[model samples]
Target: MGLYDFTFYDLIHRNAVCYDGKPAWFEAETGATTDFSAFKTQVDCLAAGLQKAGIRSGDRIGVVGKNSLAFFTLYGAAAALGAIVVAVNWRLSENEVAFNLDDCTPKMVFADNEFGETITSLRDRLPSVDRFINLTDNGPLDAFDDLLDDAPFSGEPVSANDGLVIIHTAAVAGRPRGALLSHANLLCASLHLNHCFNLSPDDVHLNLLPLFHVAGLFMAVCAFHAGALNINMAKFDADKAVDLIAAHKASLLFDFSPILGSILDAGEKNGADISSLRAVMGLDTPETIERYRKTTGGCFYVMYGQTETSCLTTMGRYDDCPGSAGRAIPLGRVELVDDADNPVPPGQAGEITLQGPMVFKGYWNLDKDNDQTFRNGRHHTGDLGRFDEKGFLWYAGRKPEKELIKPGGENVYPAEVEKVILEHPAVSQTVVFGIPDPKWKEAIKAVCVCAPGQSVTAGELIEFVGQRIARYKKPQYVDFVESLPEKDGAIDREAVKQRYGGKQPGNS
Candidate 1:
């Protein structure tokens, strides 16, 4: 059998039957919890609901909401029944949401009440979506609970290569591309975490990362697969996350570098005891990683992978080597390559390319992207990196087209924000880039050339963008220029960055 031989079908069923009373997932805000026994039934029932709704194998179902127990169940149930779960980033603007919905055109979409009006507003543009279920509460629309009340669905014939999840990527040209992850892709990544971290049922995991991204959905479920309790937060708050970690004595944590500070600050301020954490994973500096180890009494874990590769294709639990993303996992191989896909020497910088079961099948409905990305049977990660003398992989920068802004733990593509900024009548042309911020780690900055004789305030432009896209994608700092520097009749991005990207962004 190949490395991609297994699926979660057997593992989930085994865990459900073996660890029947074991806790599966919990939401700290509502104090809602579900055990494995209930989770099994809930997933089956949801699967039956999808079947009854006329959803067949290979059909796509959309979900747009915050982290919750129901969200995990929705994903699990769809995978069990051979339907692909399309996770919509709730932070996206209506138009951005429409583009994705219009792309995959799921048969039914499940959403929280917070987006009821937004979803209703998008109904006209989503021609393929026939049903909308209220995920949080019973409203005028169909309720999620109603789906669970249906007769349980029997397991389907499944394959490791079957599509299970569609995680959208903004890494390509500012447009959202759905990366179709197969069952093997998800399972391999989850199992890699389990194997490397020694995750077990006794572990309590605080899953604060957003589920719309792989970092949240894929990593948290590893704890679930191990029969561990996975605590979720609807929205991130340092105090709340810390309290939950302390109260539940969470053993594992996944968060961005900036968020870890917030959690530590809240914990320290409130005098909350978060000593139970034994493994905290994400980006952090040498000092911060040391602090995390000292504070949580856990090994600080760091790794690198994109939505296209599920999550962590590589990880290292180092007490010494500080900033490395670590070597590629046993189940995968990472190579630094030049433009023509030829491997560069260990010391030389090149594009990071991955070959493993963790790699997603390909982008949904994008043959060209899939072919290019899956060239030579390996997923080409657009990230630039290199291996140190000791073989530790280090991040460099992104490819020209794939520049990303990770503000407040969300991936913000500059082109996507620029697309919305150009939509404003007052704006003529703009170049968006990220700048280092103390709070968000990296905050967005937009350099603009306004229409002749037309005036626009920075606040107005920010508001204009905030309304049209995810608020995090809105530029934290905006600079209006009389005229933008040009190269080959296009805005010179480097010149724009040098001019406007250095200033510290105040809190927005």
Candidate 2:
């Protein structure tokens, strides 16, 4: 609450005055719109009601839902009261959802009506959760709309450095770790992104990504910070997205893998006019980027970032550097470091480290992890990359301990997948890795050796893993071999990848 401090609450208040009656957000499902002024009023009332419900500074509020007015309002209300919102990925399995909620120990849980049964079943396990508020109109629990009060918000002053949200990232070990993000982290990220995308009040943003993801939440916040209109979709429908763009003249959107591809296909097939799109940002294949650019005449921006960095650490137009991940953003310092914490020359690949305002607070409750990550005065991203002489970064994949695979932008660690594959009785040795794919940009592939007397089909093993974990984490391609290469008495993952890295199955 310093004199110069600026938080999301401050941004909302400023927009309410600056933008006034201008349309701020549009709900695609219901065709409802909320202007900036009305948005502020809703947030204030929600904040007052939440405070009355015993929510205080440092309190945790769990939210599991899609992109909706209620979801964004909860974010604003929590920020105003200095309460941290734990945004859970509703796409996860019931056990995974329960694990995240238990880890955060929220005071209240707000969820979409679709998850009423799931949350109700976990009520006994969540001792810290006092109330379960439903975000939708009809549900078994108390409705989120009922929590709104017209009374003025009266709570302790909030600081920009206070933790505002906790987003669980990919499991590096056995379970996902909640990454705590402060108000300053998100505000800085949004401001930087707004500048990068040249966003303005006249812009219309199509919110397609899930709010639980860093990219989704940051993009929405960036659009709001720019005083632009954000059209939110509870779930992505390619045809509906094209129609919305044509009808609303959306100027920007964030794409991952087949999203952009599907939009282009839908637009071409239906003769939909989507010429208004000016900037499209996210991870996608070169072919898709080229198609999007040629089809819509928009700039395809590339970036490299993690949840720990709040959002984009580096971003620039695709054509600017062609294949590189653009230059480091103005707000942050991106550097490459060797194993001993020394700087590496421009051309050599090394672990990526970040430092600046956009860096997140730290993992929610993992002190040892924070200590290791923040060592040497910079946040070790566990990702490897190299910078060219011109300063554009070329991503070189993740470190061994942090081996990751992003299928359609969702982080999936190889170790986590491998762990699940090993649980099958018919599997003796296995290695999981990522391979380039036309649709998902990257798809998980597993090479395994069957047990001596037990045999299992690829489909059976894939289904077994899917049932045990999130379906997205399941391998898209599986290949069985009699023996796998070994090094130092351990299964050599690198050897396995080198042999099976080809896009087609049974390549060896």
Candidate 3:
């Protein structure tokens, strides 16, 4: 079958009966599993139920919850019936959550029982929502469980170009923006990814990343297309991860480096067998990649991309090379452009740009923002990168707007500073950013999360960093928070600024 001809819904339903009774999706904690046949039937029923409820194509349906077996089904059902799936970040504060819901204007919302209070609080503000379905047994709201009671109906013919999902990018350093994706875009991405990995039904994916993000959702869809089993988790818990890996014999797994660090520490301390694991994939800074290789001895694939371009534009194949994020996958055209949008020298740092079928249509309902993000049909990814002598892509850092400019006109990339901080014996995790100051235009600040039973003073850390890097680049201010916030694999810059931006000790 031609890759462009198939929709994501087609892949699951066609294999539903063929892979029926096979474990389609499994939850680690509860040991709950859903077979493909049952899942397909339920998805069809749910789609019909939504259709019967007057939901139609082009309508937005917001889904907010921790990872659950029902989450996948609900997402698929929404897409199959030609409705746009708007997956919300449940971890957001009540205000942030309300802001996004109001901005997106979804026709219906399916929220977890845990978020009932938050949803109820914003009920007065969300006049656009026609239905509110709850994920858990806590009543007073319509139960999502009742969705399965409708007639078993298959997906109707859908256009490849129709909108499928509106994934709102998390506000790691700025406000969240929703990227609209079409059925063709997601299907093409999944197909290319499946082929590149040589995915097979024998493969089992250990998924711990939140389902709301493109990283998690694309991985799940890619695994499904390959007829692979998916072992799902609500969040990344190191101990539970080890148990699930040992139990399921998961052959393929994907997670970010931070999560990987946790898994490695858990293994070293508590001890667990992960012999069945064939490959572990995600973002890996060069140092982290080497450390991961020494510890796991499993094939590691370092991937690089943003949600706006679907899951990935570049990734190195396992066992192909050590540090590259691989050549641009199949259909994608990857380019390195300077500030003026001119091609940079092979080794020179430039913004990584990509154009392909996998790129999203545009940010949902934000016309001016969409125009700015997409240029000449290429998605301008605001990441700095360069090509190696061997033609492997290496991520340098983020764009200047995203960087921390320190006092004395010194530029401090957080990733670079964090890398050096991570090298310190006592420091487990660190985030360095420029905090506003009066004496200096901006002062470098370090907020670190220490390893258990480990302690280091701010002065000691300042001295430690001074000995390693340039004096100007060393943090002038250091704060030890219980935990530095994070979203989408990066530091929570927005939260940090809001909490401790203005009126520092050196304020005017």
Candidate 4:
């Protein structure tokens, strides 16, 4: 560790002295609360135990679970020990989960009871995993608490620039790639957000998003850094969320699609008092933003960022620019560049690229991909956007090569889904794309061409795809077409989207 460096572990120690007995986090499932001083002690003990379990600096620790006290505790322990935490999305299929675990090849794999059986089934496939520890209490295995020890952490000092976490993004080339984030990346991002939100010890954050997601992980870190209380929910429940908000006077939260809408509905249905909520951040529809504003008089913050950027690159209140994604954040440089990597003039659409401390180190163990992504000294986001005269960023869409779909905020690449669809015997050609949906904000829609003399129903094809991949990646809407448009003997994906992307009768 450098003399001038300040890592996440340093922040935990600082908070222990500064905030001491103040509440740091609350687990909704267990109704357990841990204060800052005790939180630090727990993290230290966990770190000592993890070190004894053969975990060392630069080692990868796999975690697959929902938002919980145990999950965040592991994060703290990893940060202190300089071990990289490869947090896998629990919502993924067993195959998907195995792919992620094998990709990182963690020394120790920790999972909640829900995924205990799934991990056990894949034990043979994970060669590097020496131990599988359960994160919950009821699991029939070695519990995470068993790893706790009172011994002080005697590991080598960890540097701020050392890799801390690895979050795998949506598949771009038939498989997902892990983006490695360092301690400085996360600490810098948390500091930036702390300044942006004006967070303090009195603030209460309702953490509903899954811990495997960037938004969820970063927001929790930011709240913790600010000495704010984070109330964690294993999974989002609108009614339960409303009750928690009323009970805790939560000051802020991160939302995606129907979450904010459902919260409003639940608040009204229960006559719950949620007036304490001050700021809500993330992606949501304009109607829902307006409704939230009218109902609670709270600010709705919109942002544009990716997992590679440590969570956020730009953020601002929705009312500031009705349809814009806010302005560039202070800590990073956001530019709109053309294909040649030249800067585009204002009012023109171009790919969004970013650079700064907040930018991640690189994808884990993928040198060629890292080179291509970090070419020209900037991280190519593969997303397109434009800036207006007043400096507000207007998000256009994604580049063709990186076209993406988010059904309820989970990233789903059309190419991955298209591959699964084409596996069916009855499918000859298929095009998968995203379409606007009232509930999810964006829903996956598939336009398929069946093989000659072989027909398949939409339900049958959807089920076939679901069985092969994560259910969320399966098409929510399917349309059978006789044939797809072609250009130069190749399927024109743009043409297919333009012609059949909209909602159709009996498609859903």
lDDT of each: 0.82, 0.92, 0.75, 0.91
**Ranking of all predicted structures according to lDDT, beginning with the best and ending with the worst:** 2, 4, 1, 3
- Candidate 4 lDDT over 109-204, as tens digits, reads 998998899999999999999999998876855777788999866657899999999999999757899999999999998988888889999999
lDDT (Cα, tens digit) per residue for candidate 1, span 38-84: 88777778878888788887989888888887888888778777889
The residue-level lDDT of candidate 2 at 133 comes to: 95
Query: Looking at model 2, how many pairs of residues clash?
Result: 0
Task: Pick out the ten consecutive residues of candidate 4 with the lowest summed lDDT.
Answer: 499-508
Better by lDDT, candidate 3 or 2? 2
Report residue 153 deviation for candidate 4 (angstroms). Answer: 2.0
Task: Give candidate 4 regions above 4 Å deviation.
Answer: 505-508
Model 1 quality (TM-score):
0.94
Clashes of each: 0, 0, 3, 0
Candidate 3: TM-score? 0.78
In candidate 2, position 248 carries an lDDT of 100
Q: Work out how many backbone clashes candidate 1 has.
A: 0
* C-alpha TM-scores of all predictions: 0.94, 0.98, 0.78, 0.98
lDDT winner: 2
Instruction: Give the Å error, residue 66, model 3.
Output: 0.4
